[model samples]
Target: MVSPISLDALQTLDAIDRRKSFAAAADELFRVPSAVSYTINKLEEDLGVELFDRTRRKAELTPIGRLVLEQGRQILKASEELTALVSQAKDGWEVELRICIDSVLTCEPVYDLIESFQRIQPKTEIRLSEEVLGGSWDALCDDRCDLVIGAEGVSPMPGFSIHSLGEVEFKFAVAVDHPLTELATPLPSSAIQDYPIVIVADSSQHSPARSMGLLDGRSRIVVPTIKHKIEAQCKGLGVGYLPYHRITDALEEGRLALLTLETPRPPEEISVAWRRGNSGKGLKWFVERLQQMTLDPKRGLQSADN
Candidate 1:
């Protein structure tokens, strides 16, 4: 029969890997260097493998030891979380909840929800992730998030529960000093293609990526977030569409000019997406509050004018 791995041995391995030396790990753990070495040898003998390269000045993990260390880190994380889960079990609270927000959204709207959640379940840990475009949807689909807010409301994937947020308007905006400002009304696709467009790279992992407002042959510069895209456009580095609500003040102040395209883009109806089954009580409570969520009336336009 195979021997079962001990959690103490795993911790010792991690301490050694992290410290890069048995002497240092022993110091950190308040044990003698010999005791630490004994633990390592015992673990290796139990697993029937060499765990460290003693030939090196600093002990380095063997190939299989590196793999075990990686898996051990995951187990260590799960074990720590198990304590929190058990502590909250009597009250039906989640040990952790991950929320992914779209970069297009301002966090001000969710502050109240967070405050309320903390009041209701003080023990539940909350994490927030900011993603652009399909990244939010991909987070929920890939199990990285319990709920994703401001994902594209429409997607090809099935098995998700989508709750509408509101329609977000897109404006073809450029810096006031750009050549596009000199272009006559109704900028054609052909002329627009000559200028480079800045786009946010999708952070999706599993879902097939999607694109919006991009032309067939336009030169493109990709950025990580909506804020970065806006920054790129505002510096006259490139041109592209931005949310009208986000750029309204800039447009009115003449910092960014709205381009009247020959082909107008439609508003995106954004929403929250999460998987449908076995949601924890904490998740259920949050979803009820999100259902009553409202959009800002100052979102500017319902649709872009052609």
Candidate 2:
């Protein structure tokens, strides 16, 4: 007979894998390190195999441990889905949706959509979370979030489906008094490189300009968040590149100026993604609302034209 694996053991294993240390996992799981060790030991005894190789400072998964971990993750995800379904059924008239968005620019349309959705479905609760770059993908993969909004270059995970929403146009921008903005004509790529550039830490991968060879290796100041990138630019630390829509107010108020480059960068695609086979009503409703909002005329064009 196959041995039964306890949920506590499975969770402990997951926590250990995620935290990389038994003690850290213990802190997260609210148990002592020895307790976590005991749980794993019990699980291994039941399975008649060792799960982790203890030779390393951190818990290293054995071959069988890897298989068990993969299966455990699937089981946990399914359980969460099941729980969501049950919650939806019991409270069919109300829903709660959780989503993680990678870019702040995409939030404008989504926020408008949520406002409209709440008016129609007042009982539904919506939770929005934002993270930089790959964090959205990580949240979705870990089953911590229901949906993810990201730029084009993000690779879809094995069990997820991606839908193209539209594109986000990027512009080379600088503080109002920055030298690049004083140029009468579009600055050549080589000339632009002479100025220190401020860039979001993980945003280079999604940069349409960089992908097309418009931007070369140049001196750059890196900031951790979109807000910080804009702040860094405004402080005149360096010229910055960002989605045009994100700086519309600043541009209109003359706080920032968009610098015309010799070559225009292509737009990065915007996409909404969710795990495949996910049938949670809240997830379905949230995605539908987002799509509807995108088509609303009052929401305006999805991307800014330079």
Candidate 3:
């Protein structure tokens, strides 16, 4: 019979697959480059098969290596799940939960609510994954996450359920020293269009104001991430749109200034969603906690109750 595979070898293979280079893998695993190479070499010797092609600077997985790596990732994930399950069993009435969140809602008071929930359910294991707005909904549909926090405009797929958390206000903002911030009155749409503007990816299609002649298209830049959009605005790269709550601190600190517009953008609803027929104790507790935290009176306009 073949001897059992060593966990260390499996970990080395997994790191190599993810990092795609011995040096990169070694850096992540905190091992020397030669040590990483030696581990893989020993694993290959024990398995009696070559696992990687080292012809290139970055190691390429051999056919067997690809198969082993795929299985290794699953094994690792399953091992983590198993450990969580054992811990939950010992603690009683507690379970591990994984959730996905949209980046736009990251500024909301919901984070405090989550922390409070964690405090209340100390035995429960919670993990959060953040992605771009619509990506969280995709993760929920794909069964990759137990719940998704995102904007309400996203259409619910079949076999999915959604719960409204609250509404968020968006506004156009720029750096405090930006020329637009010097205006005593709301700038005309024509004048606003004269400066460089940054829009989120596909934002022109999503926001009518962008294409409806609200802002003249004199100059434009499109960015992918919300954080990048904020950074671009903060750096005086361009006037970008952002959630009002997200920019509140920056506005208060004089890092950014809100530009009053003649036409105001409408508020958008935020929601938490999950697949139907998959609800369980863990999901129930999480959803309940989310609702409670968002409904808290002290959270101001970000609260769902507001």
Indicate the TM-score of model 3. 0.60
Any residue pairs clashing in model 2, and if so which? none
Model 1 CA deviation exceeding 4 Å by range? 1-84, 297-306
Write out the backbone clash pairs for model 3.
Answer: none
Runs in model 3 deviating more than 4 A are: 2-96, 107-125, 202-216, 295-306
In model 1, which residue pairs have backbone atoms overlapping below 3 Å? none
Rank ordering of all candidates by lDDT, starting from the highest: 1, 2, 3
The TM-score values for the models, in the order shown, are: 0.67, 0.58, 0.60
Instruction: Please give the ranking of all candidate structures by TM-score, highest first, separated by commas.
Output: 1, 3, 2
TM-score of 1: 0.67
Give the least accurate 10-residue stretch of model 3, judged by summed lDDT: 204-213
At residue 52, candidate 3 shows an lDDT of: 96
Residues 176-285, candidate 2: write the lDDT tens digits. 99877777767777777677777665433322222111255377776667777777777778875677766777788888888887777777676688888877666777
Which candidate, 2 or 3, would have the higher lDDT against the true structure? Answer: 2
In the range 1-306, model 3's lDDT, one tens digit per residue, is 865466677888888888888889999999999999999898888889989987767789999989888887888888887897787666544475777776665634556656767676665667787756555665676666778776346644677777876776778788888888778657667657767877654222223212111246478766665777788889888885687766676777888887777776787677778777764666776677666545221233354444
For model 1, how does the per-residue alpha-carbon lDDT over 1-306 read when each residue is reduced to its tens digit?
764567778899999999999999999999999999999899898889999998999989999999988998899888987877797876667788888989877676676678988887877888989987787878877789898878876855788888787888888889999998997989887877788888888887877776544764368888888878888888998888888777777877878998888888888888877788846887888777777775553552122221
